[model samples]
Target: MALTGAGMSTASGIPDYRGPTGSQRKGSPMRYEEFLHDPEGRRRYWARSYVGWWQIATARPNAAHAAVADLQRSGAVGAVVTQNVDGLHQAAGSERVLELHGTLARVVCLGCGAVVPRAQLDRRLRAANPGFAEAAEGVADQLRVNPDGDVDLPEDLVASFVVVLCPVCEVGTLKPDVVYFGEPVPKDRVERAYDLLELAPALLVLGSSLTVMSGYRFVRAAVRRGQPVAVVTDGATRADADGVLKVAAPVQELLPQLVSRLASEPADALSASR
Candidate 1:
């Protein structure tokens, strides 16, 4: 099994929140509590998200993503799981990928439990706030977008920006369908991830620092189960310790070569090594 994180998409022009050494590189991300309890916070979030959506919407899957798909097709890797919400794995033609966090390509209505495509919400937001996207680009400092598709905007601009409600409910708050900071992953999703881990003979981690418990727990679980674990990433990871075979390198360059080498190896030898 192979697990990926934000670094998996960095080659596609998206920035990771933390560097290789597990240090935060971006501003503090909005928390689940803030989004739920703070009205002004919601306003700021949507305004920034409206501007950042373009980057995510236009982002194409990079080489690493395609290589992972190839590895899966060649039977070198089994299950694929990702902490990224970008949906790049599926875009790169990897099938049955499990997204640890929900995807940003969707939105859910808080009031009526309605789910809608993000593109549909984007259209509604555009109609509600005319010329806002263009104006935000002019005002924002370099328009740097965060992992969750949020950009930092001035307070005045946030106040002036209009937030559109969920169209289906007509009065509910609209939130991107993703797991935010401080929010728990859905129980069913967690269970499915464990199932995948239980079935795999070994674990391969890519591009994740595993700074947070969300992704780190899997590494610990693999260790507890006596499963051979390997980590290939550019920076320091939480799993860079005793049992894991750590290789510090850029995944975009290494994964393709790794796939090729693995494909040529005898299946019995590979299984025996694990």
Candidate 2:
């Protein structure tokens, strides 16, 4: 089963990454390359990121996460593939998880690939943007974290702050280990996730609007395999027409109840044969 996107985490109150309905404030957000190559872009990135990191760091797993974890224990779910970088699935104790989007728990220096705890970066960013701790108090209400921890804030503020250079490589750039938009998912991870998907009789997709092709690829694969695929989300999904079932609802409001119902019942009821 794959529970993906900002829709899944909305229950935990984390915002999405793209528009008014999502997290970006204005203009195109910076990608890994822009943040690395352009001085002005890096400055814009760090200024907004200085505050966005707080929200991403503080977000906790919600009931949907807990229920999903419980499903694994009950043997109702063979594996979980997620598009979240929040690490909520682990926090809720799901063991067999594949993070399609990568996690935010660690930061890697792009120049050296030396890994460091993200907490270290947060402290440094807070130190550089002294008012950050104060300013960040309610700012999450307005913005969501970009893949590299930056937020899309107003033009002036984003352009004003300076991005501190990577300590390890003064001339080199920094990037999160996350797979960004326009970047392909690593081949090894994709193969492993597909292997897991092959074990399950079907794939259940939840809380994804499926706006991006990255997440939708699995749904397509599942359907092509004739695996019963279902989608549950607030809005129309790119997979809705092809999905065997679709539910328009919030993941938080519906997932716990659904997982509990499905977990308690015999798998045979869902047409699964032992």
Candidate 3:
């Protein structure tokens, strides 16, 4: 099985939370508690997200994502678990991807529990805040799109942005379906990932630093089970000392080559041929 993270989508124009050396590159992200309790925080979030969504929506899957799909088609990789909220894995033709953090493509109502496509919410936001996009464009150079599809905006801009209520409930707040930094992933999803790890012969980690426990736990579980673990990323990972075969390289450059080699011969035969 292959596990991926934000680094997998960085080549697609989405920035990763951490730098190549595992240091945080952006400012503090929104916390779950803050978003849920602070009305002003929600407004700020929606305003920033509204300006940043276009970059994520227009991003195309990179070579790394396509290589993963090719590996899956050849039966070289089974179960893909990704920590990225962007739907690039699916966009690249990967099937049945297990999104550890939900997706930015969807929005959910906190009150009515109604889920809707993000595109629908985007239209509503545009309608409610006319000329907002043009204003955001004025600071486009200063705006940096974060991994969670939000940008840092001036306070005046954020205050002026209007947040729309859920159409289904008429009063509930709308939130991106993705799990925030301070929130716990749903239990069912965690359990399912554990099961996938237990059944897999080995674990291939791509693009993740294993910095967060949410993705690191799986690496630890695989190690405990005596599963051979291999990591392909660009920098320092928490699991570097866990007896993993760590390859510090860019996934977008390496994955395609790996897939090409694997497709030409069986695993055992390839070593013999080499």
Candidate 4:
């Protein structure tokens, strides 16, 4: 089994939250409670998201993503569980992927439970706020895209920004379908991830710090089961002590090399070892 995270997508122009070059973000992201109860916070989030969404929408899968697909096709990997919400694994033709966090491609209505494509919301936002995009771009000339598809905008701009309500139920608030900080992952999703880990003989971690409990718990579970864990990431990770093998390298260069070596090995040897 392969578990990936934000670093896997860094080469595709999206920034990770806690990587070496991270911390470009000015403040904390909108929390679940803040988003639920504070209209002002919601407005700030949507405004920054509206600008950041273009970068994510236009991003293409990089070599790391393609290598994972190649590995899966060669029968070296059976399942993928990712903490990323970018949808790059699916775009790279990996079918058996489980997104631990919900995707940014969707939005859900808080009141009516209606889910809609994010593109539709983008259209609505564009129509409602004419000239706002250009104005925002002018203010933040070098806006950086964060992992959750949010950017840092001036407070003056954020305060003046307009947030659109859900079209299905006008009274309901529309939020991107992603697990936010201080929010728990859905119970079913967590169970499914555990099921994936339980069935695998070894666990391979890619590009995650494993700092958060969500990803760390899986590593701890694998250790308790006596399953060997191999981690491929650039910096220190929470799983370093538990991992049997830890490779400090950029995934974009490492994954393709790993896939090539695996593919060249004898089928029986690869099956017996993995």
Candidates in order, TM-scores: namely 0.94, 0.85, 0.95, 0.97
Best prediction by lDDT: 4
Pairs with steric clashes in candidate 2: none
Task: Decide which is better by TM-score, 1 or 3.
Answer: 3
Candidate 2 segments exceeding 4 Å error? 17-20, 23-27, 132-150, 169-171, 263-274
Candidate 1: which stretches are off by over 4 Å? 20-26, 266-274
In order of TM-score, best first, we have 4, 3, 1, 2
Task: Name the lDDT value of residue 79 in candidate 3.
Answer: 89
Candidate 4: regions farther than 4 A off:
none
lDDT of 4: 0.90
- Global lDDT of each model? 0.87, 0.71, 0.90, 0.90
Comparing 2 and 4 on TM-score, the stronger one: 4
Residues 123-169 of candidate 4 have per-residue lDDT tens digits of 99999888888999999769898899988899898887888998987
Cα lDDT of model 2 by residue, 95-202, tens digit:
988988787777667777677766777777667766754654454455655544556666655654555556676655656667766677889888888888888787
Pairs that collide in candidate 3 are none
Candidate 3 matches the true fold with a TM-score of 0.95
**Per-residue accuracy of model 1 over 162-269 as CA lDDT, tens digit each:** 889888869999889999999999999988999999999989998988888888899999999999889988888888775799989889999989878877889897
lDDT of 3 by residue, 1-274 (tens): 8999989988887888775522433457889999999999999999999999988998899999999999888777888999999999999999969999999999999999999999999999999999998898896576668899988887898899999999998999999999998999999999999998888888999999899999999999999989989999998899999999999999999999988878777778744533
